[model samples]
Target: MATLPNPLPSLATSGLDLPPGTLVDTTLDGTWHEPLLWYADGPPADLRAWSRLRAAGRPLGLLPVLVTGGRRDQWPEEWDLCPDAASYPGDHDADEVLAGYWTEYAADEVAPEDTGPGTDGTGPDADGSEGPGPWPGLAPVPAREAAEDADTAAAGLAGVITADADEWLGGARTALVPARRSADIPAAIGWSGPMNHENDVARLCAVLRSWEDRYDARVVVLGFDTMIVSVGRPPGTIEEARALAAEHYAFCPDNIDQSPPYDLDAYAEKAVLNQEAWSFWWD
Candidate 1:
């Protein structure tokens, strides 16, 4: 069994951290300036901090809340699961949401039969072989590094970031990393399949637009779905964060019903094309 790393202390105290080894999760196009949103709503620890801050009128910088009861172990493949749920914010079930996200990507990568019992292989391999060999693993893009790359790619129009969330009184200790491994996304293709729906794409763009409007940041680094915006200032309350995210979600014009499930290959492309999605760091 793979031994999971302990939750990073920085993220534990605030809400985000830049612990080393954290992977980037977005595409090049997503490098636009905006904060990555991780939704959680469950236990007291998870709910209390978020609720207290929101109730007190803190912006929490787009930390959306979603309720679930599963453990992080349930979503081992998900990079957003917060390694150890014991230190997760408020009542949000980080595991379930991450699992759902990963499941969507997994669904897009392989056929039903290939994802059978005891099969760790995601979807069908490029060669359509189920036997374990070198199955593609979903990788997250880092925030700070990604920002640098995006800046380099955009010829100075964009810049990268790696700030300590705790540095800001109300900032979450979230760490941002680069979304793409290389500046060249198209040339760095890895997975195969559709990862997001039109609605999802639209929703992401809406969020990016909102963030861009609020902050001057723009570019997609990590994945297509993620958008990193340059914020002149970070929100201090959870309510403010929710308000921003809700507005972004509402901004999307696509229909969820018409959207297909997440595919690993598609998710990979999203991470590759959108630079913002991959850049994950504290606000």
Candidate 2:
């Protein structure tokens, strides 16, 4: 068979540089009415807003949450994103699949050293008590596998490996591709609407206000259509989460979706193939 062209550039081997963008890291300690938010591009950390939120109540560890989808035929536990797990895929396993994909993306791109002990902007020797530092590299495991590993690993030092709402899972087909591409920059540049493509900016604002009152952490960055909030370990209930989603509408009034249900997975797959900066994740 003719050798397939290199699926994509390896972030590790490639000399590509991260385009100029904002970067923020914050902790989440409590619950918010509606906390889900996405931006075109601001800081790299902004792309990880959901990851930071799910991390609440979770111990610091190396668990990688996957993002998969739920089909009517497949129950919540029957997702087949992973080849060796339940021997089948389930509806709830979408997150697991997407997360696993992210791990591979990072391995191919992000340097093993950049995410370890001294790499984060927190400054080397900053955490005070430390030794060699966090793991140098992350292994992408299926959602079930990751959860099992997290329960076994006690440090609570888990990091996230997920996809935005619309990500594709082509398995080996994904090995050679990069999570993002530069060709789509023109479309993403010079924002003309709300974040996450939602039209409701005020909805987001309202969510933020509610979350702030309920949580005891800081809300550091708030863009026209994005937010970066913090919290500790114990997050609030699911009710508060809804509020956060509502608050998001405050920032972009049209953020809500009234269209018929669409295939987010298919969309995600195409996005990865294009290798373009996701308008949903960028500032």
Candidate 3:
């Protein structure tokens, strides 16, 4: 992946109020030349520290994320990161990537038993398979009539996750990653958590960068194979939610496919519409 000069190497003298931490440079192939990220030795005590770390990291072009050691006991050290396989986020366009995925998967999800004719309608194809006619396309950014700041909302959600450590994340650690933005965190560290869905993570990061502009979204928490994105401006109407649902479906199919009662409308209502956070798990 094309990247900026890594600042993690000089973190020790950067004058940031950091806790005892471990700089990780390990990858699936072997040890990376520079540290991929720096995670705290323990879980964050409260939201204040999370906010502080986020603020401290931003000046140095480092983005803060809550890294959880899940039930599987896989931390960043154990994660099989593949930086070599990733690409730069700026190299790909968000719409094209999402459109490609929607075309490949939407037919299976939206098309049902012999339904109708038009694009949105269901119908069988030349291969004798059912599908929705065409990709629904991307959703427009919801107007921020009274939206909260993205970082504030992210910190609030992080607070909730940390407060209920026993219930949610096994142990949440604050990790400072050298990234251009929050959306690029996955590609920066070459996180392969969603490999089944998208092999080159930078492509997914492209869509995330679009989300950051449209929804005031931030990548807040990441476990071994899970993610939680805090959305500051969510869809206010079902129309908007449904449109956004197509994008979500393309991004993570398990969110709708493996989920029982597998319905797009239901997924939009329960997971996307006006919700401050959207969580995903790859199986």
Candidate 4:
């Protein structure tokens, strides 16, 4: 994968006011060619610290991302990161990726007889509670004006999550990564969080890029195998949310099927409709 010139090595002399932190180069394949990121030793006491880091890092081509050590006790060092294995986020198309996954996995969850044209699987016995069928297309963007700027909403949501880091993140820390965009943060670190589902995280990032453009979403927090994004514009009606839910199911089936309610409509109403924060976990 192509990359920007790493500035992490010069962070000490970069004249940015930064808290004491360690530069991480540890990967599964031993040391990486350059430091992937720099992270503070502990959680920030307040959200101001995060805002400061983000402001300071941007000029130097660095971006801030919240990193969690997960309940299983995994951190960046133990993440087995493989930046070398990731493709650029811009290389793939989001709709194609989601559609592919939708087509491939959406059928598996339902019986072969239950899946076909005109059957959406929303019926009570269908896998998704909606009738099971071929991939549904992307969700429509909300026509209503966004409640807030994407970046501003992301910062606000980050503060909320950071304030209660233990409750939301297990034990999360702030890290600055070198990336072109927030959606690329995971691929920049070569995160294998969704390895059980999709080995290449950039494909998922592609879908995120679409959300960034359509819903004004930001990649706010990342856990060992979970991701939470802040959406400035969320679906305002069940019709809109139900459409969005199909995309979510294709993106992370576990978020709907494995979790309670076990129905797409319920997941849409509770997780997508008018909700600012969208969290996805890959099992």
Candidate 5:
């Protein structure tokens, strides 16, 4: 994957004002040649920590990302990052990657009886309506205007998560990584959070990049196997959400199949409609 010249190695000597932090290079294949990231040793209890980090890091080509250890109490060093195993997010097309996964995993699972129009001639069955085909095309961009700018929404969401870091992140700390865009942060760090579902995280990042353009979404927090993004534009109605649900299903089937209310309609109504933050977990 293409990457910028790592500045982490020079962080201490470069005279950037920063809190005491640790530079991480630990990966699956021993230590990496250059520092992959630098994370605060202490929890950023202040809500302004993210914004502060962003201001300080942006000029140096370092982007901010919240890293959670999850239930295992593991930090980045224990997460087994593998930068060499990742591909560039821009290398793949979003629709193609999503359709490929839909064909492989969703085609066989969605039976005709489960998704046809209601018997009463209304639309969508009682359980949950499915789109015309297995890989329903990408959801349309919301017609309603966004509540706020994408970056602003991201900063606000980051503050919310940081405020309750222990409860939401298992004491995860804020980290600065060298990434071209927010969507590429995971692939930049070689996060294997979705390894069970997709080994190449950049493919999913491609979908995220598409979301960044269409919905004004930004990657906010990442855990061992979960990701939460802040959406500037969210569907305003059930119909719009139902359409978006198809993409979510393809992106992470476990978010629907393994979770309660295990139907697209329910998942859409509860998770997508007018919601600013979208969380995905891969089982």
Candidate 6:
């Protein structure tokens, strides 16, 4: 895969302010030829650590992300990461990848048991369209009327994860990945967090890049099979929320199918509408 020059090897002697950390090269296959990321040796106890670490890495082309060990102690090294399987993010088109996933999964019959409260056993959703309908296409970029600074939003959510982590992300540690932007952190480290949903994570990163441009979203926290993103600008109305919901569904179906209110409208209302952060889990 094409990549920017990895500066991890030079981090130790680079004279940049940094906390003690470990350079990780372990992968599912074996040791990688080069280090993928560097993570602090301790938990992120300070609320400002995320922003501080991000600032330190920005000049060196390393982006900060929160890595979680979860309750099971499944840290990054044990996550079965497969950087080798990933292609460059630039190689994929977000709309194409999302549209393909939409076509592939949108038509599956929603089993009666999967239906949620306020949802009919079978019929049109609040949006007047159902899964069997044509792909809704991409949502237009929303106005940044209620937006926060992207990094500030990320830091705030980092504080939330640090304060409330345990079941999902309490084991948060600040980590830095060598990448040009926050959206590419997953693919840069060869994260396999969503392998079950999509084998090549760079494809998902492309969608993230699109979101970064449209919504000022940043990759915040990553666990073994989950991720949290901080959104600067969220949908202002139910109409816009439902449209964005289709993109989220295409990105990660579990955010809808396996979530409560097993339909687009409710998921949009609860998860995507006016929310500053979004979380996803794979099965």
| The candidate that achieves the highest TM-score relative to the unseen native structure | 3
Q: What number of clashing residue pairs does each candidate have, in the order they appear?
A: 111, 90, 0, 8, 0, 2
Cα-lDDT of candidate 1? 0.27
Instruction: Give the TM-score (vs. native) of candidate 2.
Output: 0.20
lDDT of 5 at 124: 45
For residue 116, give model 6's deviation from the true position in Å.
15
The ten-residue window of minimal lDDT in model 3 covers 113-122
The regions of model 1 sitting more than 4 angstroms off are 1-195, 199-203, 224-229, 248-283
Best by lDDT: 3
lDDT of 3: 0.84
Q: Which stretches of model 3 miss by more than 4 angstroms?
A: 109-130, 144-146
RMSD of each candidate relative to the true structure: 18.8, 23.8, 2.5, 3.3, 3.7, 3.7
Which segments of model 5 are wrong by more than 4 Å?
Answer: 110-114, 117-132
Cα-based TM-score, every candidate: 0.22, 0.20, 0.92, 0.92, 0.91, 0.90
Better structure of 1 and 3 per lDDT? 3
Stretch of 10 with least lDDT, candidate 5: 117-126
Model 3 lDDT per residue over 216-282, tens place: 8999988878999999899888767877887887888888788865777777788888999999888
Compared with the true structure, model 1 gives a TM-score of 0.22
Each prediction's whole-model lDDT (CA): 0.27, 0.23, 0.84, 0.82, 0.82, 0.81
Q: Per-residue lDDT of 152-265 in model 5, one digit per residue for the tens?
A: 899999999888887877876889999868999989888888988898889999999999998899998887788999999998988788888878878998887788867767
lDDT of 6 by residue, 139-201 (tens): 888865645688898888888887766755657888989998788889998899888889999
State which candidate, 1 or 5, has the greater lDDT.
5
The total number of steric clashes, by the backbone 3 Å criterion, in model 4 comes to 8
lDDT of 4 at 277: 95
lDDT of 1 by residue, 187-208 (tens): 1121111133221222233334
TM-score, model 5 to reference: 0.91
Q: Looking at model 6, which ten-residue stretch has the lowest summed lDDT?
A: 114-123
TM-score of 3: 0.92
In angstroms, the error of model 6 at 90 is 1.4
**Candidate 4 on 145-220: residue-level lDDT in tens?**
9977888898899899888988987887888999878899888889888888898888988999999998999898
